[model samples]
Target: MRPSSILSGLSCAAFAILPCAAITVDLTSEDSIKSAASTIANGMMKFYSGNVTGGIPGLLPGPYYWWEAGAMFGSLIDYWYYTGDTSYNDVTTQALLFQVGDKDNYMPSNQSKSLGNDDQAFWGMAAMSAAELKFPNPPSDQPQWLALAQAVFNSQALRWDPSTCGGGLRWQIFTFNNGYDYKNTISNGAFFNIAARLAAYTGNQTYAEWAEKTFEWTRAVGLMSDDYYFYDGSDDTINCTELNHIQWSYNAGVFLLGAATMWNVTQSDLWRERTLGIWNATHVFFTSQGGQAAGQIMFEVACEPNNNCNVDQLSFKAYLSRWMAASTKVAPWLYDDIKPYLAASAQAAALSCSGGDDGTTCGTRWWNNGVWDGATGVGQQMSALEVIQSNLIDRVQGPVSNSTGGTSQGNPNAGSGGDSNPIAMPAAIETSDRAGAGIVTALILVALVGGAWWMIA
Candidate 1:
């Protein structure tokens, strides 16, 4: 009769001996959880060809941006941390190190064509995660994890455009890029996220101060609402007066972890309030559909229901699940409140992994009730992997700091002049600012000629 009814009758009995047997995970069993995570992790890596011959180590295939590949590695790092599985560690380390760029920042010249501040920060966040988790270090000759993160921070700090929107980072690093005039939540939220994590890991007050400054600027410019809902971005050309108002799960996730990290480092009431407020605001991403999928499962608020989520948006839920789990470790009290959402979402995400020829590939829609929505990609696999393994948050220790066994070296001036050379923009002078400069040059020439003739007279 109906599609759901037909699948329900056949998927369990014909497809498996057990009910809805896609990814069989037991919420109560650690072994079951890890086994299920391993399956999803393998399925997700099927899309990665970076380690093969003629393929770049740090790059994902086309239709996926360089930033997302960095994020995928972050998920893999979490996989190693949570499951103690070294299966993906070498590749994860390889990708992170290969993309460290000429200046050791994530700003590889190749990606400059489409790189945004948020893009660079994702790799930096991964490096920060490696330092905090003590993921096996690169050889002594390679760039250190903590130093790469600090380089990203230092470089972004210099690009923090006080020239527009009072103070906030632009979406694009180069003025020639399309979004250079927009100040988005992800860009600044990422900066704030890295600052808070760096502060906690390094015991540095300067990072904490930058965290506060970014947060306040985000609020003052109205990217962060009073109730803690984070919007997409704003047009800086209009002085950030108009907001995009499109809400995404990762935006909230980035700010939540940053605020939680601040609370962990400072133990201040302000950060505590901000942390709790953001956590509560994230309730919007969870929907409790009745029947088998009765729990509050997460979905991409802006794109999931409409089935229009792009490659990037498909992976947004992964980061939200990721940071939400990590936040509990930073703020232990959050463990109780956050545990149920992760559990519910993980189960639903597993159910959706019954797609592709292998029958283990994940779909974007988690509430599909064991029926794969026919979607399969690196993003789908990553989203499923992160949400599923996040159930192991309580099994491991919280992220370590420098004083607490972290060994990655730091460089206060690592990215001091990383901004010195940007790609030269061909025909980049078509703006009104350049047009005004042209008129001024003509007037200056006229004045110079007039002065010379008068001297001759």
Candidate 2:
């Protein structure tokens, strides 16, 4: 076992106890980071009841969607990779495997009505991380990690719509879903992220081409601005005439790491320039001018300052923190430029984990100078857990490729059969099967009612 001072005497099962005090991380010490991450992760998992009765594996409770659960597992995978902590690995693996539907892709029948392309991609990305980091594989009979990721990529590749904005995946999968008319950055950026990582891992030219195509389409559609500020997305009903213009941390983060991965594999001057440009543009999210934070902490510039962030938006910074830290591994030149911001953000994020009954629950606002802000949820805890653990990026090796010791198998044609089709809604919902189609309909209705739910992701 990896040596650890905090977990030295404790068994893996004992790691779930909530902290009585707020986490403390000495960014310079690996042990301190692990200890702090352990507390924050436990605090975060307290919101999860997925494995208990009346709960579903791979699914979070009310107000939390399946996609966020996928994202949270991705962070947990990172936690295991960084700290050598196996405390949550079993649950993480269980959740990831349970979501891989019958086709071995992430398009489970239960999530079909509400599943957006981005939602499925989040789980696929987690599987990809498992493959790259050599996280323990599932049982021999279960779906493998790299193949699961490829299955997701293959499924999404078929959904690429050229009819509206030249070429881009719609925000939702089904033509009947509310966002089928909107082509958003997260959906396309997520596709790009997976494709680029696949290209890097498998050394496949086709994935590389798709990644390049997606980037060009995003740029041409005006969703990605000239200054590299990636906007939310636009509706295709107008032929992409109008843009949302609001920027999100995850949009920029998703594309930034994809571009960086492309550069890592191709070493093309063009990819290098794009990667650096996007990295530079990300400075907008970091405080540079005023306040006590002033260029230190990372904030969702569009919503955080106004205290208007929804549950999903609260977790956006987690991906931003995750991608920025992971990008440094692929693009080593980014290490110096990205480290300070992550370090300061980790410090601030940890301070915000001083709320909730355990006193270690995280809050949405990190700039509140250790004040709880009375906010507590999976997103807040997750955002804190991610940024805090990310400070260990420099301590580990970069992600690996097939040529570089990756063992998870891949299937280029994994999701092309009956499973590729949009999940069919049942003619009638039985009481016992309400968790299937009924929940899907409810989610679709919520999305339709929100109308602006696309903006939140």
Compose the digit string of candidate 1's lDDT tens values, residues 1-457: 0001001112332444333347878978989989998998888787789899998998988778899999999999999998899999999989999998888989899988899999999999999999999998888989999999999998888887766667788999997888889888999999999999999998878888888888878877777877898877777676666666668899999999999999999898988999999999998898875234454799886666656666777789999999999999999999999999999998888888876556677777787666777677888899999998999999999999989999998887787674443211112112332221122111111111112110000
Model 2, residue 399: distance off in Å is 0.8
TM-score of each: 0.87, 0.87
**Per-residue CA lDDT of candidate 2, range 1-457, in tens?**
0011110121112244534255778988999999999998888898888778877889988677789999999999999999999999999998999899889889999888789999999999999999999999888888899999999988888888776667788998987878888888999999999999999999988788888888877877777866788877777886676677678899999999999999998888999899999999988787742244568788877766656676788789999999999999999999999998898888888876765556677777777665556667777888888899999998898898899999998877787675533212112212342222112111111221123332311
Poorest lDDT segment (10 consecutive residues) of candidate 1:
1-10
C-alpha lDDT values of all predictions: 0.81, 0.80
> Which candidate has the highest lDDT of all?
1
Model 1 has how many clashing residue pairs? 0
Q: lDDT value for candidate 1?
A: 0.81
